[model samples]
Target: MSKEAIVARIEKKPLSMTINGKKIGPIDVPVGMPMIDFLHHYLNLTGTHFGCGEGVCHACTVVEVKSDGSMVDTRTCIANAHSFDGKTIITIEGQAKTDASGNVTQLTPIQTAFIEKFSFQCGYCTSGFIAGATAFIDRLKREPVKRADLETAIEEALNDHICRCTGYVRYYEAVRDVALATPGCVIGQEDKR
Candidate 1:
């Protein structure tokens, strides 16, 4: 069966949104433009990445902050700029805490764990991993996972992302370590060991 169908092209217009807490746009942007391009070319946020144009690779994942302050991972490659018209997003650039003068004060614990565990190789997938980990950890706060199920939970969170360098064990260990070390973050039965 032929799957070709013609859809009317939407007119391009200016796009403006708050990115990493900064106002951007009122600048011209076309409708249907991939957000990865906008972030890289328009905003110079190369950290969001562009591994596969398709969302399957998971390397271009970004966190979308909802109106209620909850977050979810979104694939920028499959999403358009207008999809984020009134939304807040956290990219790799915004992962660290800033000091009074705007200098980076500290890295998020996940990033720190990655550094401690050496969780990346070429680092193309680091941003995606970090974004996913952030989402996962945030979820644990609301709905904690069992101790025995911790590995599975971490796997489910990060298994989709493709890493050409690391075989993923290190990444898994890093996320798990953070969860375990964070103190009362993930709810579970007491360890019997």
Candidate 2:
């Protein structure tokens, strides 16, 4: 039940799998290696930005599936390399591609919405927000959301990423706009004061 004991028990194992459609893990890597290092150094998925390595900034947030079939956010900066044994993950790079059908493929509606609305200032947090919010919006699509409800949802979705460039308003606006613009989940036009 101790960290040293557990690590010593599995010191010689490696992990590998498909990430954003590319194969990773199943290869030899050091025990307790951080996922961020593997992503940025080995596989080159730079879209997963890192703001704070302590997991408080949420900038490195990526979606991965748990064994229970539940999707959750994990901080790549501190996540152990071997923890990703057999799970599917979606990172910022995964959302940047499009399809040959000319339908704006991999970039989710929420990401497109962020671009259309200029939802970022320094742009450091956009990737995290995009990945996090798109997943949130996808779930919202399964239900009904109104204008006010949309604002609350966007606010809740981006409660982590810190923006010192004073672009928070625009970021929130962009997400709300995307949710509303999305068919069947629209927030009414903002009231001009």
The clash numbers for all candidates, in the given order, read 0, 8
Model 2: how far is 114 from its true place, Å?
1.8
> Which lDDT value does model 1 have at 162?
92
- For model 1, how does the per-residue alpha-carbon lDDT over 82-190 read when each residue is reduced to its tens digit? 7788678999998898977879899999999999989898899999999999888877877788888888999998889999886599889889988877676567656
In the range 92-146, model 2's lDDT, one tens digit per residue, is 7776675756344566666777777777877887777776776666656665566
Mark the 10 consecutive residues where model 2 has the least summed lDDT: 184-193
Q: Model 1 TM-score?
A: 0.87
Error of 1 at 187 (Å): 1.8
Candidate of highest TM-score: 1
